[model samples]
Target: MAATELKAQARTGVGKGAARALRREGLIPAVIYGDKKPPLPVSISYNEALKRIYAGGFLSHVITLDVDGEKHKVIPRDYQLDPVKDKPLHVDFLRVGAGARINVQVAVHFVGEDKSPGIKRGGVLNIVHHTLELSCPADAIPEQVTVDLAGLDIGDPIHLDAVQLPTGVQLHGHEIDPTVATIVAPSGMRAEEAEAGAAESAAPAGETKE
Candidate 1:
């Protein structure tokens, strides 16, 4: 993935009042740490940061921070937003080394739903895991994991082992490979409705006692 270029300026003050002032001026306070380097306080344009965040996958995507003409390769570690206004408040970045290994949560994408045999049989697709944490080299981070449901049957399930990981990427730690998605029969409520309708239609007509 291409690096998203962001321009930021060094910040001097550190306090709630200072942060509020920066927000009032359409700026977002942030910090960059990791790689055994001292944490550097900085501020970035709120509009620019919001744009990146809205572009999706901002946390997993590599970003280039330009501070006073110096470029820093970093990834978004955390961020905050105004609870009421839903505006960007602050962001945290982690400086990555050339060969650094990092743990990140990658999103899962399901495909071939229309071609799934289970779906054609009126089975519901139940997702067990929506994301998986993976450990990989900083430069080799995967955008997302794909799970195909082309030939899955009603009782078939997709597990973690079925996902294909990119080179240099692996599941983080000894986490058990759990079910990612599965096909199940339709809801019991629908079955009950059908049974009730059949019983009412088969009932004998009431006779008039005149």
Candidate 2:
């Protein structure tokens, strides 16, 4: 996909009063920092900022910032929103340099649910992590991690090692391999299994429980 370009203007003021003044003018206060460079104070159109936030993967996708004719490669590090109106208040963008690998949380998508034998048998798909933190090339970040559920059986777990990730992307900050999801038996099936186990435990000398 083509990169998104956002236009911004260099701002000269600081403090709450100045920020409020910008907000009244339909602009959002923002700062671009990182990559060993001094922070650049800027303001963006409030409507444009809000629209990007409403769009999914705003934080994950790499974007270009056109600040007063100077272009910058950046990714949204964080942002603040108004509690009452849910409007964008401020934004923090991190500068992305060449060959830089940044950590980001990518959404998870499970596919082939109907093809999974366990799911067909009424087994529940229990998700452990809805998003996985990954470190990858700043320009090649993945939109989401897709997990294939075909042929998975009850009691089977979907582990991070089993899922295929996009090139240049790898799990970040994890010391041990993690389970993304698990297939669990249905309530009725679980009850039946428990009852059968109890009966087997009660039997002695190979004799069946009455």
> What shift in Å separates residue 149 of candidate 1 from its native position after superposition?
0.6
Model 2 lDDT per residue over 1-210, tens place: 257999999999999999999999999899999999999999999999988899878888889999999999999999999999999999999999999999998999999998999999999999999989999888888888999999999999999999998887889974468999999999999999999999999988666899
Minimum summed lDDT over a 10-residue window in model 2 is located at: 168-177
Off by over 4 Å in 1: 188-210
lDDT tens digits by residue: candidate 1, 1-210: 567789999999999999999988999999999999999999999999899888878888888999878899999999998899888999999999888988898899999999999889888989987888888888888889999999998889898898888888888856678888899878874688789999999999999899
In model 2, what is the error at residue 199, expressed in angstroms? 5.6
| Candidate 2 segments whose C-alpha is farther than 4 A from its true place | 195-210
